[model samples]
Target chain A: MTLAIEPITPLPELHRGRSLHNVWARFVNRVAVLLCWTSALVTIGALFLIFGYIVYKGVWALTGLEFTTHFPWFDFTHFHLNATFFTSLPRPGDAVGGMRNCIAGTLVLIAMASVIGIPVGMLCGIYLAEYSKDNLFSHSVRLVVDVLAGVPSIIVGVLAYSLVVRPMGNNSAWAGAVALGFIMCPIIARTTEEMLKLVPKALREASIGLGASKFQTLFRVVIPAAASGIITGVMLSVARVAGETAPLLFTVLGSDQPIFSMNSHFPFFHADLNNAFPSLTAQIYKYATSAEPEWLKEAWGGMLVLIMIVLIMNIMVRVVTAKKMAGRH
Target chain B: MSDLPVMPPAAPLRRRANSAWLRFVDFLTFGGAFGGTMTLIGLLALLIGTILIGAFPSIHQFGFSFFTTSMWNPVTARFGAWPYIYCTLVTSLVALVISLPVSLGSAIFLVKLAPKIRFPIPSALLGKSSPSGWTLLNPRIFVTVTSFLIELLAAIPSIAYGLWGVAVLVPIMQESIQPFLADSVILSDLPLCGWLPHWHVGLYLAHIPGIGILFADPAAGSNMFTSSVVLAIMVTPIMTAIIRDVLAVVPPELEQGALGLGATWWQAMKLVIGFSKMGIFGAVILGFARAMGETMAVTMIIGNSRPSSYSLFSQGQTIASLLANQFNNADTDSERQALYFTALILLMITMLINGIARVILLRVTAGGKHK
Candidate 1:
């Protein structure tokens, strides 16, 4: 509802408007406003300052692209291994070393994680939104999901270490992917449920009216309507797990050397998911805490790349959402 | 003969086969969806089960003393978690104390103030007043960017914060804030303040050590206070976003009614906040959970030194930090099990807080319907 639009008034005249009649009331109101304004400034300033400082240090250290790429076959330093991807360990004061292996490892693990996570999370979401009735079972399931969302990442790491790493007799990318997949599941599932909930009930009814089964109605009509939201949720889940260091710390355990040791016999066909690998986030933690200035610089650069990926993903979500809204209109 | 042809019976058989195939597909897809939900529940159960089983060795060995013992001697194999637990509580509490007001204030600013001043000046009154100055300070540009900036802050990894804290904030604290506090007369000159500055309590609270160390003897700047500051900054985005969301759903009519009844904008906001108190509490609890479980940054900055001290300025070890620091190097079975115990504790705390928050949030949403 529109209120009557009044002309602009000076502070005193606005105070005169019966809403804040007394001088003390006006003073309190003004002070409250000032406090809030200052808080906004502080919060925004802190965010930009952290990002700006990282970029500044990162750009200064980014003298060469050497640190980001490694062509293992071309380098030909070791036993001429068939697996041609590895993250070279950062030697003290070594300027030539890069995180090619870490980047590749991160991509591989995330891809594996998404393959496992997305379908399961999306399916769970569909079940919650469409299939489940409001009953004791549904309530318990919801409670479980909520609690799972809050479980610490470190704990997840420990669980992975015990469950997968120990049983396999080795730390592996598969274990890390499983850990990351667990972290992604609750977030994706919850968001997907919410997104699907937003799909109009009438859409389901219309599909059913057109002689469609419940499965067809959900898959063809409701899912397409909520597709963008689900994609956003998936992207967000990937971004969330991409920066997680703790889960990977114990599971993948991080390698300094460039190694893609998944089934070596089938290089083209299989990834040795059972081998340790480096990741960008784990490298940042390792390098940042070290005393060497060179490693620290590389850490800053890695952090910069990570922040960019996360920001890009977040921005895409907004852009996609905006486009979807425009399309609806 | 026309009604009962054998060819028609053949057509019916074919249609039955197709329908049966379709039903099977439906059953398969339904099972897939159902299995996904079951998997989520199973994962949660498995994680908790693993932690509990791993924790058994430590729990069985230590008994009740596990909570009471202060020493964390790996050599003696005498593991006590009291220090780390204490550190977690102190840092999280301090972070909440610092961040809650600021986050709430920012939420209020975004929801209440920004909208009121976003309009263009009308007619000749625009130039007479200082319109440019007003818009420059409280511009639509500033408001939009501020909201987006909060989300960006949340997107940043905790390790980055740790890195920033160690590389940047550490020196600033060591060179400036710590030394300044140590030299300041506020601890010496003020009445009953000497004790107050250090969070010192008297004989009544004997469980606490003498003259609580919140501001006691200063060491290197990597201390409880520093970690708390970092945690505060880290969780502010979460707190502000949650509060803002809760505030958004508060019926505008409630606030408008307050305004119509001669209350100011700030007063109306207070009404909105009061109405959603349960939700705000839940949000703060969630933030507290975040602060307590935060690892990389707290580990990097908090110094992770042994012999835990209460001094906010002295080095301390949080449960999460202790886990992160020692997990890789835990050589013996007992040491590793003790680390598992730490994880179990941290997990329990986080889960409990989240559970409480969920309940509170449910109540808030349910209550909002009545109003």
Candidate 2:
């Protein structure tokens, strides 16, 4: 049997008139589109402009003008990396030397913060994702976490001062880490919960059907599957807290000496958590606000380093997330 | 047959022992997680408690007059949060004013315009599209790069912004922007003249009883206006990201349906925006909270002066900046308590704003999912 197909007729075009309403609507659409494009360009342009200015000033501060003596010709001798800027301790009376202590202090503080933050955050995330069923307790925890995330870092500093510093009788790395950890907890928890939620329900059911306990299933299967995402969250949180200056202001209080010192005996490295700790952000604040011109240059250099670290981490996370999204599809 | 059926009651005791151990482990893990969550709640409570305790002395001394009075003389021991509160509100409101339109426009562009404009690359030059048909140079990639750049703005340390404000923005504002605003006759005559203070006409209108004291001669580079601009820049990325997410969640069919019914692109956008208006409002509130709590950058650029006037170009202080400047060097116990009192107020304001924003945002996003 042959099927007969009828020829299709296109619908007649509707009357296209330049009425007042149509014209006004078209004009508004065009204006709206133009405004959107302009705003996007402006936002991107501002980012580039700020980044460009920073890079220019930062490079000038880092490399100095000594290379100008051999301008118009290639000379490798005068162009040397600012080694002293990263290696030596900051000098007094004159703002000279490097931010070695600050860098080391920042690292120590971050390590301490991660130690306190990661487990608690991950566990709380597990609780929310695997156990809670929209109950009041879990609901309140979520709300509190959101609120904590929004609380000003400076207020956290005040909390640290009152809770740790006042009790300890001085500013210390412990207090700084606690403040940073407080900031990191909610961020880490939020991300972890989100990541865990992304894992398929089938995976959990399969593990459970295999006779694995809930705890075993979470630790052995679900967590492993979501490991990379959780790591990304942790790194993002680290990047965030690494740049926090206010929270460290009264907590660590800024020091010229390194937070850790080498000892001659076994377990040689000693961390002085009892005293003020040097931190990159706190030191940057100090240098930027100081009266010395050289200190300002140092501040710029520190900012360049800090920005590089943060941007690199963020870019890495973006790339990972993009890859994961692509892979999922 | 009896011997086969009797096959050793399946090691029931040993199986029970193993199961019991697993149950104990599960209990411990659950307890640990519960403790962690409890710690978070405790930490928040402790934070509020500490600030309240610290501020108690000043709260007792000043009474409710602290909220109404503007006097903050430390030597005389008379303290009030009125000026700081006023400045904080003004700065945050100004920042919201500056950032909202820019962020909304950017979000609209990213969500609406970007996906429609296809790049005409040879399919052969690019690999075969994935199952999802997304390729390099697709809208997703463009949006990703743009969003990443925007978020980089957030990742920038506040102190860096402070340095940039002091070294770069302040000079520009002082040399050009402030002067232009102060002298511009058109701006002075704008319909919102009550709010848009000006220098040229402000002098004549100063005694008119209605004109604002916002615009004045540029004093130092660091002033209320400059700080507000910095805060606007700081909050723009956050607002843009949230607004973009909120807009993205609106079902494409809604906009398409509007367009299919012969509506313009702007009209369709208006429909979608109307649908998610609560979410956008929440984003604005979130940005406002961020601006209110911002400390280091505002401190660096706000001139850190005792608040005296509402002039846009005049030096002023916000609660957070005041706390940053004075918390360390607070000479007297009363002064310290006063600073804490101001901090407690800031904490309460930000938390309240944040809570409201989160609830609104949650409702909107959840509603979208349900639909």
Estimate, for each residue in B1-371, the C-alpha lDDT of model 2 and write its tens digit: 65566655655554552488899999998999888888888988999999999999999999889998998787899999898998899999999999899999998888777653355554455566565554445546677778888888888888878888898899878865666566534345444464665644323322234444577556578998899999999999899999998998899999999999999999999999898899999999999999999999999999898766777778899998888878877888888999999999999999999999999999888887887
lDDT of prediction 1: 0.80
Note the DockQ of each predicted structure: 0.45, 0.58
Compared with the true structure, what per-residue lDDT tens digits does model 2 show for residues A125-147? 88888887888888889999999
> Which docking class does model 1 fall in?
acceptable
Which ten residues in a row are the worst by lDDT in model 2 chain A? A65-74
Single-chain TM-score of chain A, each candidate: 0.82, 0.90
TM-score of each: 0.84, 0.89
Across A119-186, the per-residue lDDT of candidate 1 in tens digits comes to 88988898899888989898778778889988878888888888889899888988898889988998
